[model samples]
Target chain A: MSIILDHVNYTYSSGTAYEIQALKDINIQIEDGQFIGIIGHTGSGKSTLIQHMNGLVKATSGAIYFNGQDIYDEDFDLRNLRTKVGLVFQYPEHQLFETTIFDDVSFGPKNQGLTKDEAGLRAFEALKMVGLDESLYYQSPFDLSGGQKRRVAIAGVLAMRPEMIILDEPTAGLDPKGRDEILDLISKMHDEKNITIVLVSHSMEDVAKYVQRIIVMNDGSVMFDDCPSEVFKHYKELEAAGLAAPQVTYLMHELKERGIDVDTEATTVEEAKRSILKALC
Target chain B: MLRDITLGQYYPADSVIHKLDPRVKLVGTLVYIVSLFLFKGPVGFLVITAFLALSIKLSKVPFLYMVKGLKAIMILMIITALFNLFLTPGETPIFTLGPLKMYPEGVKTAIFMLIRLSYLIVGTSVMTLTTTPNQLTDGLEKGLMPLSVIGVPVHAIAMMMSIALRFIPILIEETDLIMKAQMARGADFETGGIIKKAKNMVPLLVPLFVSAFRRADDLAMAMEARCYTGGKGRTKMKPLKYSGNDARAYLLTFVFLAVVIVLRIYNL
Candidate 1:
């Protein structure tokens, strides 16, 4: 399955004095099971763009197609589309309100009109997928740690068993250990379940390490859409867009500029380390 | 679209009304509203309307923008006018509708009530629109300072009001964000009965209350860290001081009130 956006444009408060063009004419294709990273500065339309894929925020102009069918078509089931394309928003923890973590995670499945038993089963599976312990399933979500609460929030979405899941700044405001735990959990899901993952993040290092493809957004437009290695090569343009390549990419560039024969395209620490050692040899 | 709500929203501009001491503006608003009820007939209403027009012009806020604020109370005004039109009895019949007879007195009462409601809203809105929240609360604290002798916690009350006003927009934005986040999770907020709609609000309200509490805690801690002891001896950077303009504002209000009183005394 593929999610294709056709010349999408979105403007907030269209007729008012505060109208803002959040997304320009954007066109992109997101294929099935492709782990993609979307990076951008604040107000650069990354959030607005991802919101379009699931039809949460309809485009002011243009169309979004899911598997060759327009999502905005009259007969299209928007609730069904939402079930198939899950979205975990920033500060996902705020959405958790059920008395127990189990019920909270199952809220989505229940809304999808599933039987109670089946919804609970999905909640159990999703909780396990997010690496949450079964013992904590009965606990009040508010009583959990900050990171645990976030996992419960994510499990609430994963319970729907969507073919694709988009997370917006999933690791923001988490401690270092919490951030790594979340990253690893999502990576494991991508690897094991083979689900398409659209990660909207601010960390270049994380994107370089995890995603197969990177999309750089600049002022409501896609500045670069390529693999991490190729995208990192345009370091100057990324900088002008208020973003930067991973630290390793910068280090490699510095080494090459100092007359050391090195691969400036190295995006991760391991790749840069290997390239520098190879040059020295 | 939810963010388009502009009721009681201040419009910033550099004008005499905006620059005046908020205490003066607050007192001025009180005098204007009192003067409205003191009017006996159209002559008195005309005088009060002229005074309101002068203040609105001095504020430099767009006339259309001021009128926009009246939309929130339009329904109330209509209901009151309807009650007056159909219920009031008089000898002079203006018209007839079904079993309800419209009389000259009924029509006059309806029009007067409409004018009173509209003028009340426009007059008070001008006060709120010209004064910043901080300044409004400061003025309120000082204006109610005499109540301290009655053991009233005037400072605390004003502080609470100011904080509430400041959080209105912040909480609104938070609610909008929370609602969208829940909506993305297959939560249907529309096309539901009252109970279902309220059930949907749980996902929104819980998070909003949680965040509001967290923010309050943070603000309290911040204030404590800054040694914000209660208003016992707290001094202001811009203390409320009456100037030549404030005196002139009071004199003008007295003249307007006296004219209305004279109109009533003479049965004008």
Candidate 2:
């Protein structure tokens, strides 16, 4: 029910002349059914940290416990772990290779050793859950628009029925409307299925709107871990680390600084709007 | 982290060999490889080995680093040695191993072959280690200029070579990302027979091919936007010229080749 990283340290190409330490002594606990947002600048070890959850990349020096199982153990079933902790990468649409959208989404379920019928049904349900139209099911994934292709890619992961799903910059390179659509879909999944969601993103506003908890990473270390409102309070530090709080957080802080009595902790626009109106009235 | 792979194996150092014009190094390498085949007897081999050792010393690259290149061809060396040991017709018999007769001549030829192969690999490695890929391509373009008279499209060929060299690392990084993405979708790459393993590669290769073509298209457009024509009337930023060191290198190489040829003719 929990994934815990205990003092993990990862060094790339340890013995070579090009050796580098990508992650440094990181520790974080992610509980069941919680929507968490991980925010970090480029090369802040966010991607490396997420890869550890599914055991895709083993830590050079520490242990990762997924559901109380030491994943580093020699006999551990990594393939099963991957099924349960599905990951969607940045530009996920580039991964679609099957001739039809249905077959592409079914690839994940089929790999779980399901019968063809069962896999097909699961794929259908998953595609529906992602809000894709039935008319596009039989078309080549290459023919789909950018956002639609991404939805199919997500459906592929959804078919696995993972307990926890991690997405790395799922909305990157999309238009504002497309970004909101993807985030809303993810939020709905977190609410309806009670699935653990680890959304790794660089957009503070998106994280503030949908995520309950936030983890800020800086230079391969966890800089802050708390509820979104509390994490946004350290706006100055975040800015110094090449990141910034949500726009609303900054707005609220500016209002307070201008001698207006206001709550500066509101992380989202809706919350900030309510607090400012309440103080004015 | 996957991007840390070192490409082209160019080791930066300050030395006489490193400072010589790359065209000279290219020609020297050709002469060196040709000399190895020209020498047939032990005297010729000794003379060549001494010359190779001196060249390696002047290159300022570690001897062990050059030897490391031989590891890649170890299997080929062993297989060829085995064939020569068993297949050659000989007069004097040493022993027989499971129906394959062994002879002194066979053993001698086998040992000589292993030595030749090892030297060949080490010799080529010395050239690659000292010269950067840019320098190598530049040397190739200039050295092949004479071939352009016979309509070889030398400049276009050089441009293609340089572009391909640049994209190899980018393509490798792209492949790594695609493989990881597929792994997240429950694609197993670690298990299976040869056929299954290749089948597993489809998930990787498709995306890689797509991205590579996209990159090539973008590069072509970029070059067109910048008005890059063929190498006609083009000027070099740092044109190559021969120095005293290069002249001396040529003299030493020719002298060594002559010694090997003389010894070979006399059967020393």
Candidate 3:
């Protein structure tokens, strides 16, 4: 249950005047059940890199393997592989096509060749997993609020019961409460289902609170792939890449620089508070 | 799949044709098309082809791109030629195949038809290759100003055309994204019969239509908020005026048209 990208490269608008090299040679392996957070500046190819995981975008000049099998091989069932590695794109609510929430959620499971009853059952359970009420299942997806629509989109993917899920900027354009609600829901999905999660984010604070492992991308290549604490240690490097460490991590580092015997690796505010209290004692 | 549409897509270039007034180009295209239909024999077709080549050169658009555009309508051109060659009644029999006879008149008509259609396409291509969509819309609004006296609402029509042109590339890009999103959810769009293929389009088409309407609604609201009130009493930031060069160009086109009309009248 691991994904490996070996020397992958991607170019946009290939063979045209507007051709752009979006990703250089990139190599990384994501182990099973790892809650990986990916961060990069806009246009740094973070989105492109994640898309390769589920065969959404084929690598221009390299290979991707799912659990040690080359996904691009002629015999490989890309459709089935996609179901095993669900991807919820940014503003995924815009992809909702069905009339009702129930229909939208059932779309994925139905495509997987499940019985109608089984698909319906999974759709209800997936909606429940995303904290959506069963009564709302019959309601028009267009009538739902922005946040609810977003959740329904995620539930649509979850209904397929993928082993891994990748989300690109899931919390973008949301209010603070909406952001927290989505982050909490994702964390719950990861913990309860033990599904591998790849979260592509621009916000340091959100990734800090939710992700266990961090993969920092810069200019279409992986700069760091480590636990959140290890990756945040290179705060200066992250800043140079047009990214920042989480606020709490920055504060902890500032305290450490001021001769406080506090752990500089604390990612969340609560963890930072504990570090501070330990240092005070 | 919608990305394959390349009609009226501007290729940015720095050339004299790109700098020409859109209205001049538009009128020139109209004259050129009229000349194409007026021309009868090979000599007139040669002259029109020469003019097309010169315009293509001035535009600095790749010749291969024009060929690519022609390729899209290749089947139509071939079918028209075949229809004329096989069906047209003529006196001079060139050959006989069992009961069917081929006539020199039919061959002449087929070749002439092909040349006429090619010229029409090339003339229009010159107009689109040189002008940006915005400039074209502006030209259209100005060109159709005379119709406004008949309550045509020319400005509104031009505005709609401009907005539609602007959103075409955007909508195509969005469709690509949605297709990928659904494909990642194991929705198979390929490897199906015609009916199954169309049924598979439900996921892609529904989302695309939904997003398009959402974008249109939002755009309308934004425009209304910014005091866009149906182009009433609107003044242009870049007002269009005919130059001396435009007059000269128009005169040249008129002379060309006169020559074509003479050829047609004399059956030359």
Candidate 4:
């Protein structure tokens, strides 16, 4: 396992008037090379839980272990731990401070004490990994469009080359084309690099199409943890938890409820189309 | 790191101070601060302190919150007092320490200055704790309307202040998010020397500045779309007017100021 959270509990603004229990008793194991999607409504503790994997947030009561070592141990080097488990926050371009794109992407590896030449090579490689052109590396990051800026921010993290990458709502606020482009880049990173990918998203369609496994959270608790198809099968429960099944699954379910002979378990449009054609035949 | 800011935080309560019109509260605060400078002797200080305590009680604001606010400025307060104690000359010296002499006049001046500053801070804090930022801006614009005859843009200035106050918490939240995002990328801010820590701010500051500009541009466009053009011929939905209660409150403050001025001249 690359990351394991053991009965974790996290509270925001603890001991203040605004104290809120964000996560409660969250226990899960994320294996290396697994593509996992975390689905939840707003403020369901998905962001808080992912922040724990890299020691950004210490558990209020329990523990988090990374690669079989307790990350919160006194002797643990938390900086090294962060480099190993990269986290890209939502709308991460807001953290961009460097004058040029190349310098921004090289920030992580340089901080890790990599030699200039090595860090440059890593930054170049990371930018290419996200489909940014080499010619634009020297241009100011402020010149980039919204989608390109997002990619540059991700490359800033990818330059460190972590074993696991956790992204919180990475595709948020992007148009559909931009969202798909970023999603495809993430999928390629997971497949080609064999990296553990934990994607936090609110879109059922995206989770159904890309992720191998899904974890659903509701009101500071894990509602379901299973394969995407299996989790989507509990459509009513998911809906009650403020999440909807993918459109294909929803349409199939509606058809099934209306006396059509179709498999309501279909999670993708292709599968739903095939089932509908079969039912018509 | 920027999450600890408590500015513009109004604690909701149903007390006499909270119920007062914001304009009344604003004028009352100004009068109280002026009285602090006008008062002379321990009797005047004692009277003002008592008034402060009663106002705090009436406002239903926690005493500890005011103490916390004072603690933030304790170092500056102490420096001011120490400077006065060592510098002011008097007829008789109270103490001498390594070429620094503390005179009775210096001690009296320091104590009075400290008490005056403290009371001023607490009185203004009471106004902020009771009035929301929107209400405060409304009161400010109404109070400054007389400046319009001199060609001053009072409404525009008040609008700017109101917007800035509203965005303080939002900017703080954005800064917190940016810090966490950089920290996740291995930026260490806690363990470095001042220079190194400043260098660490590169990643955090770049993004924050960029986002701030973007937000500003977006806000400008949004405001333009709503036809917001510099407050000319603008009418307010809630026009500020003084009621009978406001007149009574202003009268009470005037009497308090008169008493403080009388005590100062008589030295009693």
Candidate 5:
């Protein structure tokens, strides 16, 4: 029911002149129903790390276990693992291709060998779950708005009924409203479906608002893994890792430095407002 | 796996050949290809082989690395050899296979064709392996400068070539990303017949083309933002200059061409 990576290492173009060590000795454990945010600078191996979860990219060394089963075992079924651990890539709308939205959303369940009726039913449920209108089911996905197309892309993954869904920068290239709407939908999915959610993002504000825990990556290694309050407390180290705490955390720290008694660990604006009000009162 | 392709890949190194002017290397490759065709017999091959071996050695690229380029054209080489082996009419029949006869002169022609093709590839690989794409384009623009007098847009052609070369790696990486995204959605690209495989490619190609057009639009906008109005009166950051090493290279090329010409005259 949990995923564990033990001493994972990956190198791109190994043994060639272009060889690059993309991941180095990564070791982490992801528990069931946990909402985790993976934060890192570009090239810090966030994408490579997530890809290894479902065997999209094989590790040069070490192993990954899904609920006590070694995924890289000779007899392990990778396709089944992929069905269970759904991945929504960055700019996922770009991967959409179907004559109609319903078929596009059904692509995943149908690939799992579901009958047309079963797949269609799953697609219908997934579309509704993503908040898509029933009318758009018969329309071309290309004709939808960017945000709507992205919802369809995510619905495609949800139709598989995966226990865990990992999204890589899911809000990228979306408007601020679209970003909040998408994040809200993702949070609702985790709460209602009881699904494990791993969000890889560069936005500290979004992660601070929704994710229960944060994993900070630096130079292909995990630098921190803890609750949001504890992780944001290491703002200096995080900056060294090429990231910053949420802006409110910095503001709270500044208030404290100015001799006001405020908790610097407040990462969200609401938390900062409460802390600042308490200190003033 | 797609990244394994090393076409027009330059090997970074510091050596005599790398230091030589790119124009000289470009012309040297042309001369070498011409010399390969000029060979008439084993003696001429000896001369050509010696010249090619010397150039490759000076370039400092590993022999294995240079020869790896041959793998790409292996099918073409084999097809040419097979055509020569089965189609050439000769007096002596060496072997027979199911109504097809191999002749002695056919064997000779096949061997000659294989040698010529391999030597040409190796020689050209040496040139490209030593010269960076930027330097090669610069050399081409400079070499074709004379053509501008007759109304050829040499600068624009060179600029286009460099841009195309730059986009190759970007497009490859994009294609790999798009493929992985589709694969995650359970789009099985492999494990299908030819037609099914092509049909599967629709998911990959449509997005690739859209992104490519978007990228082109962005690049054009960025170029315009920088006030780039096509290569009119553009000056080089590092102008091409012939140095001592280039002079030596030219002298060596002169001798090699002379030897090849004399060998041709003697019909060797």
Candidate 6:
């Protein structure tokens, strides 16, 4: 119930004039029931990293082990691994193709060789899991609003009942309210299922608010892998790498500069508020 | 895996061939095709081969890269050669196989036709593999500028061509993403029966078409916002101009054609 990437390296367009080393000597272990956030700017290989988890992309050099089985072995069941590790891509709404929302969600379960009726049942549960209304089940997925469409796409992945779920920028191009709703839905899924959740994002605040541990990547290598509070302590280094700490982290730093004896590593609004109030007292 | 498609692929280089005006390369290719028809005997073929070898050397593109494009047409070349080997009537019979007899003329023509087809392909590759899509469309628009007077819409045609070329890589990238997304949904594209594989493509194609249409709509709106009127009285940011290299290239092309024509006249 875990995934390990051992000494992985990936090269895009290898041996060509336009070749690029996308990932270099990466090693990571993702254990069950851990909610982790992978934060990096675009082209920082975050997308490439997640694609490897589900056997969607093979590493040029190195091996990935899922649940203690080498994924690249001669007889490994990649399709079975795909069922266990669901990946929700960025702009997932674009992947919806079925005439009805329920059918589209059931696509994943059906692909896993479930009976049509069984798949439909799983799809129904997945739709409910994403908090979509029962009335919208039979409607065409294309007719749904943007947020609803995204929810259906996520349910498509969820119907497989994966042990782990990886979301790549699930909130991209969404309104602020939609973003909060999706993030909250993801957090709820993590809490209820106790699944290994890998949230790939570029926003510092989004990860800080939801994930327990943070993996900060810069130019294809991991810069920090620790708890959110500890990762934010290196705000200067993060800023130098073209990423910023959350706004509340900056607020705490300013308070500290003004001689307030507050903890500077508070990553969220609530933590920062408590630290500031305690310091004032 | 889809990257193997070398359709309209341009190989970047800093050689004289690459730096020449695209119009020059286009004309040079035309002249080379014409010369391929004028050659006669072994001497003519040798002359043509030497000229082609020199041009390839000066182009600085890898020989292996240029030849990779031949793989697609290899079957056609072999078929044509085989046909020539069996059917052509000649005074001398060189060999026989079962019910078929091979003539010396058949052998010569087969070898010649094979060489001609290969050279034709390699010659055109020199033009396309060197000229970028933008430059190619620019060359086409300018070369056919005379037709604009007859209401041929030359500029519009070139604009369509350039836009299509620009979208090729973009569409390829989008297809890659959509395919991966579908694959993650447990869609097995590989290891399926033909009918099953075709059915599996539904997920990939649907999303690709959706995104492409969305992108087209956005592009159209953006173009309208910028007041992009049709190409009447429009000026290019990078205008086409011939250089000393282009002049020499034209002269060399004419010389090659003249030599081939002279060889045909002498029957040598």
Best model number under DockQ:
6
Which lDDT tens digits does candidate 5 get at residues B1-268? 5676666788888799998888999988888888888888878899889989998888888787788789989999999999999989998788989988999999999999999998888889898888988899999999999999999999999988988887888899888888888777677888889999999898899889888888889999999999998778888999999999888888888899889889889988
Clash number by candidate, in order: 0, 0, 0, 4, 0, 0
Mind sharing the TM-score for model 6? 0.93
Chain A only: give the TM-score of model 5: 0.99
Instruction: TM-score for candidate 2, please give it.
Output: 0.91
lDDT string, candidate 1, A1-281, tens digits: 89999999999977544568999999999999999999999999999999899988899999999999999999999988998899999999987888999999999999899999999999999999998888899999999999999999989889999999999999999999999999998898799988899999989998899999999998898999999999999988899888988999889888999999999988888888899999999
Ten-residue region with minimum lDDT total, candidate 2 chain B: B1-10
**Tens-digit per-residue lDDT, B1-268, candidate 3:** 4555556878778987787778888888888988887887767777777778888998898776666567678899999998888777888788877877778888889998888787677668778867989999999999999999999999999999999999989988998999999998778888789999999999999989999998999999999999999888889999888777778777877777787788788766
TM-score (second chain) of model 3: 0.90
Which regions of candidate 4 deviate over 4 angstroms?
A274-281, B91-95, B243-245
**Chain A TM-score across all models, in listed order:** 0.99, 0.99, 0.97, 0.97, 0.99, 0.99
Q: Supply the TM-score for candidate 4.
A: 0.93
Indicate the worst ten consecutive residues by lDDT in candidate 2 chain A: A11-20
**TM (chain A), candidate 3:** 0.97
Model 6: per-residue Cα lDDT over B61-88, one tens digit each: 8887778778889999999999999999
Docking class of 2: medium
Q: Better model by lDDT, 1 or 4?
A: 1
**Over 4 Å off, model 6:** B36-41, B73-121, B265-268
> Alpha carbon lDDT of residue B222, candidate 1?
97
TM-score of each: 0.90, 0.91, 0.92, 0.93, 0.92, 0.93
lDDT, candidates in the order shown: 0.90, 0.89, 0.88, 0.87, 0.90, 0.90
Query: Model 4, B27-62: lDDT tens per residue?
Result: 888889888888877888887887788889988877
What does candidate 4's lDDT look like per residue over A171-197, in tens digits? 999999999999999999999999889
In model 2, what lDDT does residue A51 have? 92
Candidate 4 lDDT (Cα, 0 to 1): 0.87
Task: Give the docking tier of candidate 1.
Answer: medium
Order the numbered candidates by TM-score, best leading: 6, 4, 5, 3, 2, 1
